[model samples]
Target: MPHKLSEIISWPEQREKAKTYFDSYGWPDNRNEAWKYTSLAHLKEGKFTASSDSAPIDSAQVIDSAAQLEGFYVEISGSAVQLPPQDALPNGISITDITADDNARAAAFTHLADNHLLPALSAMHQTSAIAIDIEKTDSAAPLPAVILNLTGSNKEGACYPFVIVRVHKGAEARIAEIHSSHAGLSCPLMVYEVADDAKLQHIRLQAEASYTTHLGLNQMQMGKNSQINSFAISMGGALSRLETHSLFLGSDAELAQSAIYLGRDRQHHDITSFVAHEIRDCASRQLIRGVLDDKARGVFQGKVRVAPDAQKTDGQQMSRALLLSRDAEADAKPELEIFADDVVCSHGATVGELDENLMFYLKSRGIAEEDARNMLIDAFLVDTLDEIEDPDFAAFMTSQINRWSLARR
Candidate 1:
């Protein structure tokens, strides 16, 4: 892993700009509205160095796991590895190191320049960056999925990896990013650009070790008539925070986002998102669900903003959490900032425990207590999982939920 100041100096202009921003507003504290529920005390206390330690990983096992997924797979073990040659990939798709092309590097820097603290830190210390581009083709067949796997080492240092994805006009694609790690800190950044008339299905899975700390940022921009559907599953890490920021850059764009998080033991999970409607007739919807047990904590903070000129915009957001134990905690904040008079926007949040009556009913039907509890938990989250369009991916997520529930019992 590279040091922040050293990595920033590698790019002079970005270094100066990032230095100014850091000096002005340092790391966010509890007073910051966006980070009130999440504290960086643990991260600041650790002595995090940058090192690419591959000895902890079994390359053969990583390859075997990627083979089970449906897509063109690229594995990043502290650095980019197991990337297929361009000739091996499909005609319309290309995945390459961002530093290989000067233009792409510049574009990535520009895209990341205006982001907040975590993203800025990721841009400054990123050890490697990947760029995925999909071009519009004459073929009628849907493009295959592209999977990016990020794995961290056993060291107590921070790992920085960045990804940029571009879907050309009139093209359609699917992407899955999986993050699995050991005892360390991980900060990942990603940017997605969907062109006019294009469609993208993006999925992210975070299943790091219980001793790891993870912070991630995802930024998206949608063009006219573009559609983006995103699904995220968070089930691991001692303390994890995932933030998403989306902008509708043109009229008639649409975005749908769904997320499920499971936290147990003394773990903490935070999911925060901000969606901006910058143009007229754009639509956005979000649903987030969390299950926490055994003194765990879960937090959801979501906000939707519509510009004054963005008339006819439609936006909705909902967050719900289930606490399985008396000591568990759940916090939710849903907000809407609408400046357009003709826009339709709404936000709601609910935090509660499982329905005891329903659990008793299941138990009366000959189900064991643990089984009954798991059944009710599944029923609570099935609606959101059903929102996924891909049946295979949905089934995988369901299995993960089942596994977590079984362990909790």
Candidate 2:
């Protein structure tokens, strides 16, 4: 396991800019309004040990489930990228390690957020990056999903990995990213680009060890007539934050973002989003659900901005949390900034304990007390899962939720 930063790095300009920005802000704290609800005071003295491509990993287990789903797969252990054979991958799909290509790295960086603190932190520590490209257009047949399994050593250090995904004009793609490791910290930065008339289905699974701190940044840009549906599950890590910044470049695009976060045993989870809808006739929706128990804390913060030119835009946001224990806490903030008069926009949040009436109803139907509690919990989370259009993807998320519930029992 390497614990030292690489002497030679790629994309120097981006790294220098990130370093400069991070130095100004340092480790994010409550003072930063964005980091108000979630604190990083515990990691103030922490240092990032960039993972190397020479690091060893168990190749067999990382992406077996993804492969079973007949999906294309990529595995990143440390900085080592294991790609499927070109011959095995479906047509119109390609994966490349772009660390050596300055132009490619610059192009990818241009499509992502530069001022955000998390991305700056991620950019400063990364020595390499990868990109996945989809080229098919006007196809009647559906494309195979792409899955990325990112893992790090079970050591007391951090790993920084950056990835870019591109869906070309009129193309459609489904992507799943999984983080499963025991490293003290994992920071994965991702940027997605959807061209005109393109579509993207993005799913994220953060299941790192309970001792790990997973901080991630995801930025996306959509062109005219494009659409993106995104879902995320956070059931691991001692402290985790998933922040997203989505920008609309043209009119007639849509975005649907939803997530479910589960925490217990002093864990802390934060899910944040900032969406910019500056084009007309576009729409954006946000839905977040959280379950907290045993002194755990969950936070959701989402903001939407509609410009004056963004007429006929529809934006909606809702965040709800169910606390299973009195010690647990939930915090939610949903905001909408609209300069457009003809747009429909709304935001709401609700945090509460499980319904005793519902529990009693299930118990009266001959269900055990513990079983009835579980039932209500599942029912509360099912609505989030129901929004998913793919049955297989929904089932995969259900398994993770069930595992979390089982552990609580």
Candidate 3:
């Protein structure tokens, strides 16, 4: 019965040694190394409770029913957590709502909940919270719209959560981490930290509910000429996993990793990223894309590491997949490990489908073979909305990917 959130929280022995190594290595059934390819033993054999002690949800109607990531400034509707004071943020900003007075934000949420596991299962089920701090200012604006609303509460196993974000030192920010799931078993976690010569732009949007289960973990620290541009977009979930861990730690640091996952039916989407350059002349770039239909299942794992003084390190990794059925399932793994030697690492992966001569040349231009396969699935999700260099957040993520490909055609 050891599951009242691992028996009343007293962890902090590095999360009780990673929850006693996942309780004697249980939940990774398809062989470890990041659960091989999505298997949490069917969500721990479904005894999945703990998500609804109800009440306290109305961050202005969950930011007016979510799905709006145009410009940010904290507007969550359900599980209520909204803000705008501090002379209405934005000039050398700092916004805190760490679940309001949890004994004065409980030491900044126990310094990111002491060795995380879904942010210590969302601070032992505290529900809604926010702590975004961004310093450094010498001009330039247009980077402030931190809206996080993980809605849920249609009651079936209700886990709607939040996290810790801090971006300081020579800071420049652009964040829009949005998620909306109004139907059961939903889980949400977001943790971010980017300091030193900082310039961060992270936009992760997962439009939820398909028997939702989203687990997101993003932790980054890159000093020196620091810069990070991360973008993740998963159109809906059933079992979505986004785990990104990065560390470059000073010296010409920079990273631009992108993602896009679109799944249908038995949806299971996974996008994993791990980038560690350690030090000295660092630069990294990773691109990931996926789209699976019908018997849906997609996973992309990317790893790029160049330590050993990371001399002149320049790393690149790519993953591409598009299977439109034939019992859809696509997996791509890109890896690169360079122990310096004046590093210049590379990685590649691809899985094919669609493009039957560009769908018979867009059905000979008459365009009605399901409208030329929904305009080639909206031009393959428009290269993840042009990596969102913010033209109004890439035209609102291209109108939410053409309204989720016209609601999956």
Candidate 4:
């Protein structure tokens, strides 16, 4: 097999740094706050080698095999990406593995690296970094759409992939990023920037094979007066974890986040988030839900920070989980660190099984016991999907949920 990324122009300089970072730190143990629920012993013990450069992937084949998505499409494999020209860009915007060569891209890249784990991802992987620039407009046109496709074959070893996005000022866009791999352990990192007065709606989906091991990081920056609404769904992979961190740099900015996880068999899923309110009049909300069956495990950790001067800040968070089997496990930790006395902040977490009364009610309506149970689970999760502001985006999220539910049933 080919041994190194052929497209990376700066590989020789970054190789030593990559090895140093991975070896300097131990693979996460159970004691780490971010990794308390999910363990990486299996990934670390398997003795998997880093991925060797593989052949180019077929974009059409990936799209055809994927669940249908309504938006512009781009695929990222290794450090290679294919994008349409700016003028020819579709009303629904989309691009793959892009870089920051100018000021606009730099703003987003720096924001992501400073606040999140993008620096580690950048130094380790040979994947592409994508930057999206949205133009500002007064009237709400149909939300421009963007989709990112992640694909790789790890039959030989493990691989690390990274992608980046930047939303320009006064622009509006909606994006969906999907991660898929066939034969190896894949760790992908993504970072985003929302400029001043801009609006961004984002959706993330993880549907990899059962043998796949996955790690993901999503970091975002919300500029002054900008709005960011985001959601994520996790259904496949032996182990999948997502980390999100967002900071409000401008006053009057709003940030909303929601996620759903369904894990069966021995699958493990983890979602960790941190939202920082730094300026006055900033507001944020987070709601997360999960369903676990068989021997599956689900994890959620949400933390909110309010600066001393961030008066009038409104922050609320909740996490609810359903455990369907005796062996299943759900762990949630919602934390709040505040320095401002004038702010309003609250957080709560819950773990429970289906309501027997609701199940009995559905059965009384002549619904089969199994169908009634499935219906209740669906109802519980719809709230997270309802947060999507655009109707078209909502439909896509609904389809993803339904697809996972049917498979579990």
Candidate 5:
């Protein structure tokens, strides 16, 4: 059952504004360049409803599953969950519910009002938002990691979860955001603001069930001399798309992003990113890898724009895919638009299959053909996993890849 727009907890004015925006644009189809390859036919026909109602959850089960994981856990069953008390946090870290501050809510609404369909819908139907603020001093002490677990229900409706992260000047923090779902739809929006001289490490893992559909957007704003390192691992969902929009608001900002995606058995995974170097002396790098098996499909579309005034920009992007089966498909579209003459920009893409010579070499060494293939696949993904700064999180991601490989075998 779909809930009325009025049932969502948004300011009347903002809701109306978002509704007007959504009505004008409506849902994008193949005609939309960004969504040309991915189809939304099932979603459009399903008429999915957005709800804040919490489903029955086994807290113990969730806790046990994450007991070995390192970090402070913030769990979301269907909607956002409560965080620990302020006093329990570190000296410079604060987690505040967005609803507590009307100004924050309004600012968030404004930032997402004109976004794509999923983000606009998220702004209109989001029930709760959590803001994490980090303030680092010159003490050089390592800040604690924050983990967000977004779990979806088996119901047929959709749930929208929103998160806001701010790294104050001179602060350094690591955040791990994970998404797991059952048999429904999920649309999540995350915003990050990195102040001057701040450093943020973000690790995202999307491991939803095969029957789920996930559409997620991550919006980032980087200030002068700020740095953001992002590593994402996508291994689940029937139809999953993760889009990132990064804007360098000030000069000397840097961004390093890498992603690994695995698709099998008719699954579809898409990773799209648009990065803007709006100022001078900014640098950005992106590396994407995909592993497809059976009849699965993978897509990577990345674009880097250097403004006319944005001189001294260094940007590079690379996309590579490995197809395990003849029916598997991989598509890569790497583009660069440079308006400045003093910039260094490059983009490359490659799609290929397993090397038969390597397979034969391993087989001659007394390894089974399946074992050799799995070993080669794992070796191919090791570089991407190495990009992660956290050893624990990298280990976790590696485990996911191994699990996928073993299951397919």
Candidate 6:
């Protein structure tokens, strides 16, 4: 039986609009270019409803490794939102839970003006959101992490969670996106706005149960001279699709994105991103690596666009997947649409199994076959973590990967 939508949280106008769109256009399928690798034909028949109650979870009992690290955290289970106390936050930063105030809700929701399918579908469910704002700071040490943990229902239901992060001029912030176990039918959206001279370091860890389904999106808007460095690890969830959309509204901005994924036992993971350089002198790079075992499958679709007037724009993307078993599958599609005469953009993708020569060499050195394979796998994934600037975040991600590799053995 379908549960009821949460009554405590409501966004009447946007919910109605999303409902109308669903009634007319209907949900998209593989026919849509954006969803070519992932299909939603089965989701249309799901009996899940928006969650109707709040769940309070103990931080220590959470599954995601990021939640274990020290930080000011926000915990959300279903429609409930728990923000860090104001006194606990730094002087120049503030995070707040959304209320019924029309002006406040309207202002924070501007990021979804031209919404995507996942956000629109989330709107149909009871919506819960939080706003994060940071001002310029002169602290010598790096700012502490802000962990946003989204947990699913203990019962059978769905969850819709939203977050917005704003970095003021000349400021910087570090954020960690952590999802707990069993994020059932979850559709979450996050928006990051970086002003001129601002910076943001974002790291995400998705370690949910095998029965979970997670559909998520991250939108990035960059201004002149701003920068964003982000990394993510996807190792859980039965079906997971994460899409990142980046737009450069000003000149001289930089973006660096890197990710690692591990799939086993018939799991499905999809990562898709779109980066558009609408202005001049912007540079963006993306690096993705994954390891698959058993009958698991992985997909990566990356597209970069440069406008005619956007001179001196440079973008690069590369994706490589290492298959651990014959039954595992990997698919990649990389695209570049450049209308500018002076811009440079390129993309490349490759899928292959572990190196037999390396394995043979390791075995000749007296290492067991299983030990040699694990050693080679560790080396293949270790370099990816070098791209992460934050040591704590890197270690957290690596710890989870090691655990997963052990389980695979």
Per-candidate Cα lDDT values, in order, are 0.78, 0.81, 0.68, 0.72, 0.79, 0.78
1-409 per-residue lDDT for model 5 (tens digits): 0112132245666667778878887777888888888877777776442221213224344345445566677766666476877888878889887755656766664444254676677767775688989898666767888888887775586777788889999899788887876637878788888999999898888877666777888877899999998998887677888988888888999999999888887888999888888799999989899999888899998989888999999998989999999999998888788999999999999999989999999999999988898899989998677777767767777776776676667
In terms of TM-score, the best-performing candidate is 2
Which regions of candidate 2 fall more than 4 Å away from where they truly are? 1-10, 47-67, 137-139
Least well predicted 10-residue stretch by lDDT in candidate 1: 1-10
* Candidate 1 lDDT tens digits, 6-40: 22223556646666777788777888888899777
List the candidate numbers ranked by lDDT, top first. 2, 5, 1, 6, 4, 3
Kindly indicate the candidate among 2 and 6 with the higher TM-score.
2
Local accuracy of candidate 3 as per-residue lDDT tens digits, 1-409: 0111122333344335556555665455665566688876556876442221122223343345444654446654346666777676657777777665564334433333234455555555556667778777767655655666555546456564566677887777777776766545555666566777788877777876555567766666677887888777886757778878777768897888788888887788898877878787988887888888888889988877777888988888878888888988888777777787987887888888878899998788787787887778778779566766766566666766676776677
Per-residue lDDT over 128-218 for candidate 6, one digit per residue giving the tens place of the 0 to 100 score: 7788887887786767778888877653667778788999998888888887646557777788999999999888877766666778888
TM-score of each: 0.91, 0.91, 0.32, 0.86, 0.90, 0.90
- Each candidate: how many clashes? 2, 0, 10, 4, 0, 0
Per-residue CA lDDT of model 4 for 312-396, tens digit only, reads 9999998999999999899998889899999989999999999999999999999999999988999998867878886766887
- Candidate 6 ranges beyond 4 A from true positions: 1-13, 47-64, 109-115
Pairs in clash, predicted candidate 5: none
Better of 4 and 5 by lDDT: 5
Error of 3 at 326 (Å): 1.0
lDDT for predicted candidate 2 compared with the true structure: 0.81
Worst 10 residues of 3 by lDDT: 1-10
* Model 5, residue 220: C-alpha shift (Å): 1.6
Residue 262 in model 2: lDDT: 87
